[model samples]
Target: QLTGISLSGDQKQKPADLEKELDKLQTEFDEIENQIRAGSPRYAALTGAQPLTLAETQQKVLDDGTVLLEYSLGNDTSYAFAVTQSGVSLFKLPPRSNIDKLATDFRAQLIPPKLQRRIVGIDVVAEQQRGLGLVEGPSENLTAFVASSNALYRAAVEPASNSFGDKRLLVVADGALNYIPFEALVRSTDGADYASLSYLIKSNEIVYAPSASVVAAIRQSGNKPSGKNLLAVADPIFSSDDSRVKGKAGVPAPAEARGLGLGLESAVNDVAGEPTAAGGLRLARLVGTRVEAEEIGKIAKSNGSQADLWIDLNASEDNLRSRDVTNYRIIHVATHGLLDAERPQFTGVVLSLVGNKDNDGFLRTDEIFNLRLGAPLVMLSACETGLGKEKRGEGVIGLTRAFMYAGAPTVGVSLWSVADKSTADLMADFYRRLLGPASSNSASVAMRAAQLGLISGKKYSAPFYWAPFVIVGDWR
Candidate 1:
């Protein structure tokens, strides 16, 4: 009941009443959990939500050449459990504070400070003009990123290096470590250029899960193959002033005024100024996503598969739900992604806001749970789609988990705010390999191949361009 309330974005209850009810329910739940713990030592272990035991995880979740690295951060010290089919090894790590700082520094290197700055209440037009070249270019602080990456590797992976030996990794991160993309971690700097660094991805294929139990659950659920190849949703109409909107009577929002705000209006204001007198938050149109969706559709069709595309005004919340999305083998959403750390329920993917009486543009996390997706892979090709509120044991509660619950065996999400062109390019390469003829590569393998391609390319060789995207849930 508490979870239902928390996840329901369209609840009619008043805020005060809801808060009180949630408080009461949480207290009752805690008391009941305590009683169950007291009654039997094994009762907690038997609960649906509890993590699977090491033996159970090894038997059910792991394959012959796969290993799980589950980290638990503590105040004084942190620990990692390297779980393999044959045995489990534990490694100690630095305190949570140390890891936190390193993760923050690393993210700073990837996301430009201009992009991170809050745009709310500011003159969006002026800000956009001043920051005309706000793209995430090569960082002058490359050494800083390298140092942080190496340090994180030393703290997190070095202690357990011997145990990992040529095995694919299933990372279950905790707290700040959840934000760190393990693939970006440098194994050795070794007189390497930005493009030629010895990243972890170069050697091992990696996937992520909120918990080992999640891995077991998703794998157990399996995927119901859909007859259709793809359902691509992109290029939402965020503002009525958009030139594409026929017969609308206002000046088109400037390209500079247009920015990706996900759906959190307070977090990022894409419009030129404050909300209109009628109180509507204007979001920037994602022109790149249109190209992205079209390219992917072409790829699917070229592979002799049927692809359904919802773009421009057709990309509405109503269309998304009405289309029976579960019939597609792969579901791709290329749009703005909002993350509300304080309120995970608010985190969502933004679609077309126009002509949708049933919903606002945002498709909240809880709302995603309601979707009946049967696709083996669901790719959220947007900024920061991988992030969510971190729970010590359960992992990051965000879009990845929502998609898993909705029936996707595998999900692709990004760790940081990414530039449009780079994201489109990376995603195009990914789908081409995944759906190509005679392709036996799993989702993780395909993602790795795409990232490697970017690393080898002269245009987007920086880790920032490719490392943010990761595969979660079942890799196979």
Candidate 2:
């Protein structure tokens, strides 16, 4: 059985320092193995054996009105434990077979091509209703979606949620469940319309953790980093042939631009009742995220805090891999994240493809643990960066855990592909709120503010545009 060891109460090493220690231990273990292979006498001694108990973890981490829902997903069935500081309750949720399909269906509905044309200057409720009509075209689709959400809620949450009332939920999901948007799960008891009471976010704040021990690790390392306050890297060149590589004023190559145009044309064709390949909808460009970097940079600078904003050629993978980001308080990467679920180790964040004629830009999953990043929060503003191949006991084996293993206490990631422009808007709002005076600097609080802005804002009220972003780690 796999056991998660939490940090002892007196342990005070920074996450980066802890990461360094782990690396040293691994090196030592490797040396010991070599010595054993050479037929030399080798000995290893273990010191501390105080594994954190359930009560100790609750006492150390759970605040009042906070419920931790930890899940264990087996091949056919799944079990859940709802824990608070006071007690724990177990519940049996729907099997993976049922949830996998429903969640996949919900995710398919969130794709941009499936959503309605978002009209500006309309009332929030009206706009949301319009979006529902377009996205959930048939009346039966709305009923089915609602039924699916309600079924998930009842099985996974209702048993525990009723006891916790309006408490915020801290979910530790496993397997395909890691890809779920808990906030989007609906509970309709009063016959309210889809836009009126269709989302769990309307009821409570939801966050995620890789494990209970990870939560303890995060809370123990909650102190802010002492180095630069913000590091925002965005708008990287994904190809060496990009015009910006030749210093042509940050323009895309003519062929690439044309390809993007064709991609859009194909998307339009899909919207006009013509079938198109799923890859067509996945098309992306050198996103206009330079503005996002600049706006966030201004926020960090406003309060006499230091901020480093890297864009275009400067946002190379080599730059990220070589630098020790342990000192930064916040690290934000606004680029494409290539998720290879079939080969999770190949999953990587796309950075500057080639600049100054050097360095491949894909930052692979395996390479993440090599970095020492003690930042309290690392934001991946990219598509499906949160997903990975499911392991039996390890949960989603992806970049989120990779970043955590690298020493980041929290990682903000997207569950699905998001619109570049909407992401920029949401991120700008998030940073402004997070870095402002009188701000709590609590990532989840700031994230909620940003999500609320998108949900209520005129331009992007649809849940598909905003609900995908989730904070997985310490919400504090």
Could you estimate the TM-score for every candidate? Answer: 0.83, 0.74
C-alpha positional error of residue 39 in candidate 2 after TM-score superposition, expressed in Å: 19
Model 2 / residue 51 / CA error / Å: 7.8
Steric clash pairs (candidate 1): none
Q: Candidate 1, TM-score vs. the true structure? A: 0.83
lDDT for each residue of candidate 1 in 104-148, tens digit (9 for 90 to 100):
777777666765543111222312111223444757677877888
Evaluated at residue 125, the lDDT of candidate 1 is 39
Best by TM-score: 1
RMSD of each: 6.5, 12.5
On the 0 to 100 scale, the lDDT of residue 247 in model 2 is: 56
User: What Cα-based lDDT does every candidate model obtain?
Assistant: 0.73, 0.64
Model 2 lDDT tens row, 243-358: 56675564333322223222222223323344333323222334456777888899889966789988977787767877766778899987766565644655677676554233
